[model samples]
Target: MGRVVTLGEIMLRLSTDSGVRIAQADNFCAHYGGGEANVAISLANFGHDVYFASKIPDGLGEGVVKHLNRYGVHTNFLLKGGSRLGTYYVEAGIGERAANVIYDRAGSSFAEMTESEWQKEELFNNVDIFHISGITPALSSSWKKTTISLIEAAKEAGCKISFDINYRGKLWSQKEAGETISEILPLVDYCSAGKLDALYLLGIPEATEQENELVYYYQEIRKKFPAISVLYSTKRTVVSASCNELIGTLWMDDHYYESQNHVINPIVDRVGAGDAFSGGVLHGILAQKSPQEMIDFATAASALKHTIHGDCNQFSEPEVNSFLLAGSGKINR
Candidate 1:
């Protein structure tokens, strides 16, 4: 199995049932999720060896590690006892709407973690791919420094690096974020972006549907990050709260390949669909699937995720392939 290492904060997630606002809800379901960690979990479920590195409070952190281990993810790199787990509240939408999140991550163990807490050599040693996200760098200035160090070490170790520009507006301002992400664009092997994220980083306004926008958008982004090997975008058209159509396209070696759209009529939970798509694409790269097939499988995997709750990491390979082949079926493997 290929060894993948992910570095980021893992937060405790609380979501109210029946679509009640956080202030109105008396209780909520709790789970664990963080972008890089979620991607690592998805990869592990596909049978790839994966590890997640982050700092957490002792008991709560141990619980997170044990949960990750249950999914076959290596948790040895997880550090504990710095502080409490970061948390967020989710209020899922009903009918024709989208979900919302309220992050309560400040002062959490991960946000307070020191650069000394990360043992770069041991974490990246013999690793096939190193994954990171914009979320970590947005946490604090210390995390920004930590992220830079981690990327430098991974680059020196000759590991493939994948970055997701998961811009959280609530975490930081646009100018500061644009400047920071632009600085690191040259250092990554693969970069993922949403339409808004691309426009935000490239300084382009959202395009009108009539403009054949992807072409122009691609040119601007590629010009900005000439060193990036693969630039992927997850395009989604939210038709309704229950229905959305998603597609995957990549700007690779000066060319772009657009894949088919996977439609979901009743999206159960849209949280981690993009991460699942990235996981599928990464898996396809390791399995040597063609670019088109990679997008296909990735799109299919992501579409399937809407039928499941929490994050897409809970899905297995066979389950995704079943949806790919059978159109629809029980999600369990």
Candidate 2:
């Protein structure tokens, strides 16, 4: 397995029980998660040597470190400082009611992270891939610079960069996201984005009525940012709060590949499915799987995430493969 490094914030997630509303909840369940951290956990579960880097409050960050360790993610580059960890709340959804997130992350430790705090040499040492998301840069102005610096350092260390444009509207505006992400895309080797991102963020014009929309957008993206050799995204059809249909797509080497559509019903939790898919795709790339296999594995990993309750996908690579083979809702015993 390859060594992977992911940099971003890990926040405290307080979620209501199933069918419970945050407004009506008497108590909540707590878990630690964030985009990059969730991806790191998923990679670790697949037996990758993954390290997660971020700043955490000294006394209050123990649980966060323990959470990473439990999933076999290294915390060596996780710096200690700042007054408090970022946090968010999730109101569980059922049937027609959609889930919602409320952020309380302003001025948190990771948002206030400075570039000088990280030792680039140690963080990227022998690392095969460096993964990150747009969320870090959206945190604050300082984080924007730090995110670029880390990407440059990882590139210098000969690590392939995997970037996910996990744009959060609450943190910044579409104009801000488009501007910042445009600057970062050139340095990225593997990217996670959709047709909407291409149109709005990259300023690609809408496809002609005859051209395949996603394929045209992806091809144009490659023309603009040739360094990015692989691009992937998922098409999600929300049937209801408890049911969804998902399909993973990958564009590589002038070819596009798609996975079987997975109909996830009675989803236990849907918080980290995208991160799980990202991790699985990275794992497939590192493991040198075929494009078809990569999309299939990634889609399966995403489907499995909806079956778990937390923000991390706890399934292993073998488990995901087994799930794919057995299909959904079947007894293993």
Candidate 3:
């Protein structure tokens, strides 16, 4: 199995049920998730030797580690006793409404933690692929410094690095996001962007042709920072809180490849689909799949994630391949 390492924050996600607002909800379901943690869980479920490193707050950190362990994610790099587990309230939205989050992550242990020699050692010794996201730096300036240091160390160690520009407007400003991410993109091997993320994060000018739209930006991206080996973007049409359509594309070796359209109706939860996509492509790469296979499997895995609740895509490879092979999601009786 390939070894994958992810470092960032893990938080207690308290989500309202029945489409109720956080204020109106009398009860909520709890789960452990964050950008890096969610991606780690997805890789673990795919049978990778995955380690997730992050500092947890004092009281609830151990439980979160145990939870990650249950999913086959190694938690040896997880540190405890910072301040408190970060938390967010999720209010699921429906038709004509939008989802919203209220982050309470300031001063959380992981947010306050910085890069250490031990973390650099973990990257050199255990990582074939190292993954992190924009959410890590959004927490605090210390985290931004930590992420940059870790990226440099990972590059020096010859580990493939994946960076997801998961811009959280709730956590930081657009100008800050643009500036910080531009500095780090040179170290990223695989970069993921949403519809306009490239436009805002790296200042790529908008394009006129909506179909070949992203390819236009690709030229701009290469002109500015030519080191990134691959770029990915997933197009989504949100029909409702529980239903959507997704199309993923990849640009590498000077060509663009797009995946088949995936329609997700009545999605169980949409939180971790993108992370699942990241996990799938990383898994494909580690397994030596061709780029076409990688994007196909990654997009399919993401489509399947909409059927599962919580922030982790907890399905095995064969289960995902079943859908990819023949659109088969039937009971395996």
Among these predictions, the greatest lDDT belongs to: 2
Return the clash pairs for model 1, or none: none
Q: Give me the displacement of residue 222 in model 3, in angstroms.
A: 2.6
Candidate 3 local lDDT, 1-333, one digit each (tens): 799898888899999875699998889989888888988998999889998888886668877978898899988888777778989878886776777888888778877666553547655585798899998888778778878888899889889889999898988999999999998998888888754887777887778766687788776786777888878878898887767889988887888888999888777788888999988888888888888988999999999888877888888999888888877355655
Ranking by lDDT: 2, 3, 1
For residues 73-95, what per-residue lDDT tens digits would candidate 1 score against the true structure? 88888887766888888898877
lDDT, residue 72, candidate 3 = 93
Give the residue spans of candidate 2 off by over 4 A: none
TM-score of each: 0.93, 0.98, 0.95
Model 2 clash pairs are none
Candidate 1 CA-lDDT value = 0.81
lDDT of 3: 0.84
Our model 3 lands, by Cα RMSD against the true structure, at 1.6
* Order by TM-score, highest first: 2, 3, 1
What TM-score does prediction 1 earn? 0.93
lDDT of 2 by residue, 128-214 (tens): 999999999998887888888889999999999999999899999999999999999999999999998998888989888845578
Count of steric clashes across candidates, in order: 0, 0, 1
